[model samples]
Every structure is written in C-alpha cells, then in structure tokens.
Target: MTRSESPDLSVRQRLHPSSPFFNAARHLKKLILPAIVVFLVAQAASWERWLFLFVVPSILYEIYRFFTVRFHFATGEMVVRDGWLFNNERHIPFERIQNIDFTQTLLQRWCGVAEVRLQTASGQEPEAVLRVLAVPVVEEMRRRVFEFGEQAGAEVPPDLTTGWESREREFEVEDDGSPSPAPVSDRLLLHLPPAALMKLGLIKNRGLGLVLAGMGLAWEFDLWERFDFVEKVRPWFSDATWQRIVLLVAGTVLAGFACLLLFSLVWTFFRLYDFRLTRHGDDFRLQCGMTTRLSATVPLHRIQFVSVQETVLHRAMGAVSLQVETAGGKSEGEENASMSRRWFAPLVTPGQLTDLVAEIRPGLSLEGLDWQGLDAVGRRRLRRRALFLALLLSAGLALLFRPWGGLAIAILVPYALLHSAREGMFLAFSHFAGGIAYRSGAFTRRTSVTFHDKSQVISLHESPFDRRYAMASLHVDTAGAGTAGHRIQIPYLSRGVAKSLGEELATQAEQAAFRWS
Candidate 1:
C-alpha cells in the first residue's frame, strides 16, 4: 500500500552534475564547429586566439544550468526553479500531469542517469524536463507522483494495485549490472521476444522508405561518382535488348526489395529489443529499445481513446496492433505516429484482444457492442461516389485510347458498384455505456473508441454530398486524438438521427466529470 502522506517533499533537489555533459554532447556540433569567416577575419586582424572560445558558448551555458537549477515537491505539486538572470519557477500539479517518460541514451546509461519528462494536457512537448537524475531518484519521483495521484480520486482500484506488485516478473538488467532502474510493478501484460519482433518487421515492411534513405546517404557522402552508379546503368538503356532490359530491371527491383527487407529487419531488431509492458498501479508502463532505452507511463484515467488496427498482413498473421491516446504529447502529426507506434504490443493475437482492451479501460470491449451499419441513404451515397470515380477513370482512358477505351465503362461500373456495396456493408458505429465506437475501411480495417468522460467536442458535419443525400456525419472528437489513427467520426447517418445522436452525446458529455477528475 502507498502512503497518503507525501514522501520527503521538504528537501530541494538538484539535477546530477553530468547534465552539462549530456547537454554539451547534444550541441557538440555547435560547440566544436569553428566559424570559418570569423577565424579568417581574426587572423587578418591579428586578434588573440581566445576569441575562438565564443564557439563553445553552448557548453558554457550548460555549465551555468548545472549550478542554477533546483527542484522540489510542495503542496500536492512539483516546483522547479531554473536560471538566475532569467530566473524561472514553475509549479505543476501532480493531478494535471498526464504522462511521464524516461529516456536513457547510451551516454546517460553509462553515467547511471536518466532524463525524466513530465507532460500535461494540450502541449506538444513535455511541461517539465529534468535533465539528468540518478536512477533510484528518478524511480522514487515516479512512485511518489503516481501514489499521490491515486489518492486524489484517480479511481485506480486498490485490488488492482495489490495484484501488480505481488505477481512475478521477467528478468531485466541495467548498465551497472543491477535491476532495471524503474523498479517496475510485476503485472507484465506483454513482452516482445526476438521471434515476434521479426514478424513485426515483416508486417510493417518499410522497404520503400529505405530507397529514400539510401539516396540521402549516397548524397551525404557524395558516393555516386566514386561508385560510377549512373555510368554503370547507362548500358541498360543504350546497349541492352528489350528482353534483356526487362530482365535486368526485374532482377534489380527484386534484389533491391530483398536488400531493403533485410535492412528493415536488422533496424527493427536494434530499435525495439527487449520490449516490455507492465502495470504500475493504475498506469501502464512501456519500456523498450536497445541503444537508447525508453520508459513511458500512461495513467488509465488519462487515456482519451484506444484504437485497433489490422492491415491485410495483420489478419494473415492473426495479429492486431493496439494504440491509446492520452491528454497531450503525441496527439497529432508525425510525432503521433512515431511515439504511439512504440506502445503497440507487436505480437498480439486475436484471442488476446479482449483481455488487453479490458486491461486499459475496465469492462470495455470491441466485441458484443451493438454495432449499427450504414442506412439506405448512406449506401446510395457511397455507390454514387464510386460511380463518379468510374466515370473519371473511363474518361481518362477514353482520352488515351479513343473508342476502344470507351468500352471500359461497361466493366468499371459493375466493379465500382460491387466495391461500394462492400464499403457500405462494413461502415458501422455503436454508442453505448457512456462511450462511442466507429469502424471504417474494407481491406485495411480501423476501429476506434472513446468514452464521454474524455469527449471534448461532438460535431454534426454535413458536406455538399451529405446535403445532397440528406445525410450527415457525426464526429466525436476527444482530447488526445492523433491524425488519421484516432477516428471517432461516424459518417453517412440520416440527418435527423445524426442530429439526435449529436445532441444526446453533447448532453452526456456536459453531465460527465472531466477525465482528469
């Protein structure tokens, strides 16, 4: 059991002295790179060599930060005092803190220190960053924060808390040959072994991305001419026969694909080695990576929604990826994809889906929820859109191939209608138990859900097409929705029903307490 009383909050703490070294290392390029123009002028004017020290300003600033910054806890919150000339003090409430992440780069690990990031709602970056702290101290800070939060009616059950620490754990190691720095709770939900990681690499085949990276690397090193890459390939166009050219191109493409796949596998192995997800009281903690270790905690109450993704390959392997959105941090854009993907339990099977879902939001499940499918108007609209696409394709082909291409419409219309029928059949949504769910796509399926407690805005949107068809789209937006992945929007509802549903959702949201509460 955790103490309701604060844990030694009286004493102020300073960051580890090694913070400057890490700071300097981060800006090593700026610190070490000489200004060619400045040096030339200095030499011409016969100025003293000490002027060069200006380039090391970043390193010196880091040294200044080492002496100036201090932090401590007070009045159910954490306070940080930083700088002298630009003295800044921030007071962050423990309850408002949505996520906590710890990062240990290779250098930080060697020095037995980790960087801690405290994130609040709405901002794109962490609210407070503690540069470098000893492993034990960092763990203690995390423990106190969660313990205090749990006491403040965060609704983490006492029974659940008891279950975590009492369970067994898989082995974890540290640079000092001690246990993992976090002193993690023992309710390990998922662990990714090498075999499973290999499957993930193949499933998310980012081989095409390798082509761009290869081009960039070649340009960076100016290796094209030295390798005679262009000259070597000229014969494929100028000297080779048509059959020989086709064979060469096919062979080269196949070889390149294989090479890229192999590279992706190796890269995935390094990036996601020793992945583990554990429960720490009401929070889920994910720890992974090889060269640069990462530990992130998402409180159960902070989760705005959960999404399940199953591409064609995922179905073939009987696997599905689960992602959750919290208050801030990775709620949008590229950072959203990069940060959220790391949380996916790479090897999760179909049978494991329900259990995992329940673990995050107790009693929540994708199965057994009453799903509503597209209505007659919705299906007709979808078919109309498909027909429009068919007409465009037929017209483009007709322009290219005259009368023969005009015959393409006969085949295109039937195929388009059939595909649209399938699309309409699959589009579904359900609202129940103070929560909303939406499912979209035919081939690559995506399902997302959010509860009223976390719901921010309920919008009834109508486009020109929607108006023409007497239909509307009901969008349920949440606090931490990321682009594309966090889709709670249910489209193609009859306008009247859409209006009613939107009103009900808005009323429910108004009555509900804030998620953090």
Candidate 2:
C-alpha cells in the first residue's frame, strides 16, 4: 500500500523487559577494568572508596532508561523518544533510511532478542537503534523499512501487521487451510565452505603483526623479569655455543609462529562462521558471525563499484574475494575499516565469482574483456622511476653501513629492475559494456569495475615527474571512493590519451542516468 494510505504509526511500543539487563551488562563490560583498579586503590588507600559508590547508581539509571525509551511508527517516519533528565526525540523518514541491520549476540539469541540499527547516508552514525527488542519485533521493523520503497505510494499490505496477535498467529495454521510458505525472494548466491575458510585463514595472517607488537611491549615493560621468563631461558644461553644458540632461537621462533597460525585459524572461522550471501530482489543481503550474528542489506542501486581482489596465495589457489563499494557510511566507533563495506564473497573460485557477479549485476562480465596496455613511453617512465628510487635507497644504505651496505646494492639493483619490468607489463585498463575496469598491482593483482552511471567525477592529473615525461593519469571518482580518492586510476598515460579518456568518461557520466540510491 502507498505510504499515504498506510495506517498511522502513533501506537507506541516498548522494548522487551530483558533490555535493561542487557544495557547494564554493556555498561559494566566497558567499565570493568577501571572498576577493578579503583577497588584495588580503595583497599590500599581509604580516600579512593568513594569511587565505588557510583556503580550502584549506574545500574539503577540503566533500569530507569528502559522505562523512558519509546518508539512508534508515524506516517512516513519512525519516531523514537527517550531520556529522563535530558529529553531527546528523533524522527527518521523512511525515504532517508539506507540500510536496516539486525545484530544479536549469543546471550540475546538465547533470550530471543535482537538489536536493530537504522543507517542513513549521513556517514556519522546510525539514525536510530532499537536495542534489545523481541526477535519478531525486530523482523517486523526490518520488513517495514527495507520494503518501504516497493510499497511507497501504495496501500499497506494486509499481511504487514505488527500487532502481538498477528505475531502469535504467524506460527499457527490458518482457518481456511495451512497457508503456503511465503514466497522466498532471497536466493543464496554464495556460501564459504569449511575448507575455503581454512585456506583464507592460512593466506591472511593479519593478526600475527599484532601479536608481535604485543610481545615487544611486554619486553619493554620488563614482563619477562616479572614472570621469570628470562630465568627460564637463561640456562640455554649459558652454554653460549653457536649450535645451542641457533637451536634455541629457531625453536622459539617456530613456537611463536605456530601459536599465531592457530590463532588466525580460529579467529577467521569464528568471524566468518556460516557466511552466506543472498540476493533479495534488487537488493543484496549478507548474514554471518558466530558469537555476534549480523545481517546487512545493500540496495543494488547504491553500489558504486565492485572489486575482485586476490593475494599472491589466493591467486595461486585460483580463488578471489568480491567486495562492493556502496554509499553507506560507517557506524560510530566501528574500528575495522573494512567492516563498513560488507564482502559479497570472502572466498570463491573463479567460476563461482563469475556466477555471483552475473547474478547481482546482469550484463557485466569480467571474462574475455579486451584489455589495453600502457604505451611504451609510459612503460619507460615507470622503469626509470623505479630505478631512480632504487638508486636512492642503495645510496642511503651505503652511507649508513659502509662496506656491508655496499654489497646490498648488488641484490637491490636487479630486484628493482625485475619489479619495474613486471609492473610495466601488467598495468592496463579495459572498457566493458556497463563499466570501465582498471587492472594493476605487481604482486597482489586487483581489478576494479566502476559503472558509468555511478561515476561522479572524471579528471586528468599530472605531477612534476609526469610533466617532465609528458605523461598524465586519468582518474574516475564515485560515491564512497576509498583513500585513493579514485575508483579507477590509469597512471602514466600520454597527455593526449589521458585528456581524451577523461573527456570520454565525463561525457558518459553526464549522459548516463544518475541512480545512486
């Protein structure tokens, strides 16, 4: 039904009774460490005892918050009101809502509750968050917000009921007959198998660096002495023989590596447990996570670009990852930069990648596209640049270490030359029916596809180095472009070619319809 014809949403609703406990738990979790420190200080010094007095009131305040918070559906907007001392209210229009995500932790799942987050294009934080609601209530809210576009300007559907009676009747048989199962619009596009997850764990060792940094900090703080770790290892050093020292160092390194490997495996598995990508009409839905379940949706129209990425090991295994860039912004306090943009496929074979892409974006194909390489002049410029950088590095090393560093140039020069040659050969770009693709990267290959319709800006750039060589770069900008500031970059192109390409991209962007929802 159209929004105008839909019933008014002035009927207020309150969260489940368990919400107060969950809110208190979250607050306690954040303050636990500080509380422990304060308690220890209080025990040692009487003056610090007053700090513990705040804990009881904090818990009571959270319980009070539950009574004040209220939400309701109002015309074309969702209204939320809360706060006892400092009154606050928020009105979020259905049209401005970009994504509605639901997340539930293990405890919440057991309690049959979920947290619903409403995201807008503001790029600051979620417009509204309904924390600790019944599972059925969460589902009803998501259905209304996400499906609002399809039913806009139409009468509300008869089955779109949020009343308690309707929710109870959902699982009961109808009087006429057992109703057929609701038509399933969401189709599974990809699922990461256990074997693929293991492979990903092995190839992506992101946490190892963090572990090493932690060890360094521990050593700096004299943790080894406090923990008697140095005393345990001193026996081996007492021998002071080359063989003993070598074996001791090697064993320690291998043990640390093994621990890191196991940590990565378990961490990856838990983070991506039961990963599933599904296509729901013109939108995409991603559901995953073990301890904390997360469900996110991406409208097809909001996708600005698609990236097919492969690491050195991933390429060798014939597997790739698919990520889409959307106009959605990151939620507040989200530390993982990559988490804001959901992955379409974390691990997929080439064949699976092709099928998944085709299903999501019809008429776009990555296979058999005609690729054009950089001109000889551009290639020469890249090689020269690489060589100059290598020379500078070699000079610095020689100045710092004298004779020993002088020998390092023998290794660096040839390695630099080989890298330059490889980059020159691999740098290329191609145009497809729907979008333009740029292929680059020496060791880890990445191909980014940006649709003409989503293109926001096209420009030509030149630095002093490029000016000397009469070379320029063409860049295409779109919504949600990464730190690189461009979705597609073809560097070291001739001045004329760069300008022509920029003009063509600008024309296409202007002529194409703008549908960035």
Candidate 3:
C-alpha cells in the first residue's frame, strides 16, 4: 500500500475498518474466561448471593462495551472507537509515531497473535498499542506502518533510548496479497554453531550451580530447621569448650567461602558452552541455551553501546565477554557478574576483539584509535590520584577494622597502583566522521563510541585533583536515557582535547533534527 498522495488528507483519510469485531472478541476469550471465573467464584461465596446481582450487571456491561468497540488500523494512522453511551476515540497520526514495536507474549504465541505498540512525538505517552492480531496480519501492519514512517521522515523514539516507523498505502490488487519479503527463513538463520553454544552455556550465569547446590542441599538435609548456637556447636565441640571451638569453626568457615569462590569460577566456565552469534542483514541474532534455548534478535541501529569486559580470572585466561547493549530497558540494578546481553565470544583471543568491534561498526576505524601522545600530564595526574586514594583507603580500613582492617587496607596499595597505571597507559580516543570513540580499562577494558550528531548532550567534568593535573573528563549523552544516564565518559584526558571534542559534539547535537516515527 502507498501513502496518500494528496497533501490535504486529514487524519480520517487513513482510517479503515478493522479486521473483524469477532477477531478481537475471539482473541480476548482467554482473558475474559478468567475474569468470568473469578466473578462467579466471588458470587458463589457471597453472604446472601445478593452480591451476584450487582456483579453480574457490571461484568456484563463491561464485556458488552468491549465487544461493541470499533478499532481501525490504516497505513497513515491508527484509531480506536469505543463507548457505551458517550463515544470516545483515540488516534495516532503516522507522522507523529516515534516508534512502532511488535511483541509476542507466550499467550499470544498459542493464539498466533501479536501486539503492535505505537510511540508518538510528544514525549508523554508517545504511543498506544493494539494487541492480539494474527501473526500474518501483524506482519502486514508493521510493514505498512514502517513504509509510511520512512516516507514521512518520522522519528522512531527508542523504547529505552538505547538508540536505535509510517502509513498505509492503496494499490491495485495483486494475484495474492501477501506481506512483502516473507519472514527471514528460520532455516537460514537457525544453525547451531557448536563453539558459540559451548561458550554460552559455560558463561550464562552462576545461578545454575546455585540452583543445583540448593536442590542437593534440600534433598540431603532438613533445610528448614534453624540451628541454635549450642545445638550447632554440640556436634563438634563440647558446650563447655564452645568459645575455643567457635574460633576454630569461624576460621574453617572463612576458608570454605574462599574455596567456594574458586569452585564457582570453574563451574561458571563449563556451564556456558557453545555460544554462537549470527547476523541476518540489520538483525543480529543469538541462540544459546543449555536445557532450553534462547533466541533473540537486535537490530543494528538499536544497539546503544558495545562493551568488552574481563574479570580477574578472564584476564588471566585472555578471555572477555563482548556485550552489546540495545534499546532494552535499564538494568534492574541486580548483580549480573557475567555479560548482560549476548556475547560475540566469551573466550575471545587477545587482539581479536578489536577486529570484532570494527566488524560491528564498519564505518568506525577502531584500529586507528591512537594513544601515542594523548597528553602525559593526564597520566601523571592519574598516578598521583591513585597514590592518594591508596593512602585514604589504608587509613579508612585502619579506623574501621582497627588492626585487622589495617592489614586488609594494605591490599589496596598494589591494586590502586596497577589500576592507575593501566588506566593512564591504555587510554585512547579517536574522532571519526560518524562518531567520537574512547577506549580505556584496566582489568575489563571498555571502548565507548558516541556519534556527534546522534549524541543528545555533551558534558565536561573535573575533580579537585584533575585541576592540579590540568586534566578533565568529557561525557556525551544521548536522548531517551536523559541527563546523567547512558553517558560516554573519558576520564583523565587533556583539557584542550576534551573541551574541543565536547564543543564539537554539542554543536552537532543541537543542529540534528529529532524524529518520532
């Protein structure tokens, strides 16, 4: 279908009769059945059965209202009409849609239905959704909306601003009306690479071990019982000598925890095996599951950041988790020690990851990210700051843990020195036509690249110590995540370079146009 050629077309021009009223009613059957069951159960439990009289009319009226509502889906716009007595309608013009998301829930899967959500430009409730359509119908609707959105130059707002739609058309009937470009053949995209799969299973999460441990422990003992201090100690030590026994037991417990960390590390490795990543055009797909498989696709433009991470163990093994962040929601703040999203390779050979990054963003030349003379002043500043932090940590530990804490604090000295030096020596920045990229990390190195025109904001930061070092940090923010969030920060960079880069990016950001498609 094509968009209306006439410039004078109004919002109503795009309206079309919805599939069928029965389609909505039939699809809503599952939801309605549960509500009816709850209502009947409550009525049966009522004191005098009088409550049934009130509930029956209310439920019937609601059901009737929903059944009678008329919904419209068109290439250029979408409108829903509903009312019992006073009619009400909601509309979203094609040009105003910032995003169009199609999702399929488990229930929708059984019903062969999909949900289409539309986001608008107002920054408020950007879009509304119409759910429960047949898969084929949903695909057609998505294709048409996207085509129109492209024509209108409508901006598709990100669902989560991780950075990442259009109207209907009218055309002569073809022999068969089918959604253009059939869904990518599942067979073409479904190969299971053994190596990728192995990596995925080994590194997915440590919870697998925790679950096995919990189940084994539960099966072996009466886990529900809480041990009293004396009852617990009596098995190993006489109650009269419990104090001495308590000290010895504490030492063993500490040792056991240390050993568990080591074991957990090993267990985590073997579990995440056979990880694989494949690309189908703009869509990057990942499938890796041990007992049950997980399949996910991320559109290229939807990716907000690409992160490479290595733990202390990963560093020793020359391995890293290549993570790509998309417009998915913000982290729930839980401790997910492993990669959040799909990884390219959990056991990446050193130097190969840079090649992977270049492959992901072909336009950016990561290999050209020069660190040769990126201001030695900043490096000295970082070293001095590290020394000061080490001293402060030592003092704090001494105060908090007294004698024992003081010994713990001593550990910070080597860590601080090593991290500080690594941070200074490894840091690099590259300015390209598409974006500005920064790379730095000690244990788990990360390189974050933000396009100037695509960036929403540029911020500069400096601490008291940075002032002495004549150094500054620069951050670039994008739309969606808002201020202070989803920022790209370069720590301890030359003041001149930071200011110049920030100003350049800020200017481009101001000039770029905003879209809601």
Top candidate, metric lDDT: 1
Per-residue lDDT of candidate 3, residues 141-195 (tens digit): 5555544643543443211101011111111113247553323322122232455
Q: Which residue pairs does candidate 1 place in steric collision?
A: none
**Top of the candidates by TM-score:** 2
Of the two candidates 1 and 3, the one with more favorable lDDT, higher being better, is 1
- Per-structure clash totals for the candidates: 0, 7, 44
lDDT of 3: 0.52
lDDT by residue (1-517, candidate 2, tens digit) is: 1234333754778888999898878777767755654554454466656665667788898778789888877766787888878878777788776666677888998999988777766665667777789987777676667567556624323233322223245446455477735544456788787788888888777569768766776665455655588788788799689898998799999998888888888877887777777766666777777887777777667777888788788988889888777665643433323342645677889999889778757867788778888778877887888888888898899989985886778888887888878877878898766778897876677888888899887888999999988888888887767622225888988898888877887888888987757
**Model 1 segments beyond 4 Å from truth?**
1-10, 27-64, 153-185, 213-232, 330-344, 387-421
lDDT of each: 0.75, 0.73, 0.52
- Location of the lowest summed lDDT over 10 successive residues in candidate 2: 158-167
RMSD of each: 7.0, 5.5, 11.0
lDDT of 1 by residue, 1-517 (tens): 2224453555778889889888778775443333433343454444635665664887898889889888887767787888898878777888888878788887788888998888888567667888898876786677677778668755554332221122222232433467654443447788888987888888777766758865775675455765588998897689778999899889999998898888778777876777777776777777777877777777777878888888888888888888877766654345323343346566687767788888977788789789999878788888998999999999999989997998899999998998898779888999888688888876678888888888888999999978987888999888767633657888889888899999999988889976663
Cα RMSD for predicted model 3: 11.0
lDDT of 3 at 339: 26
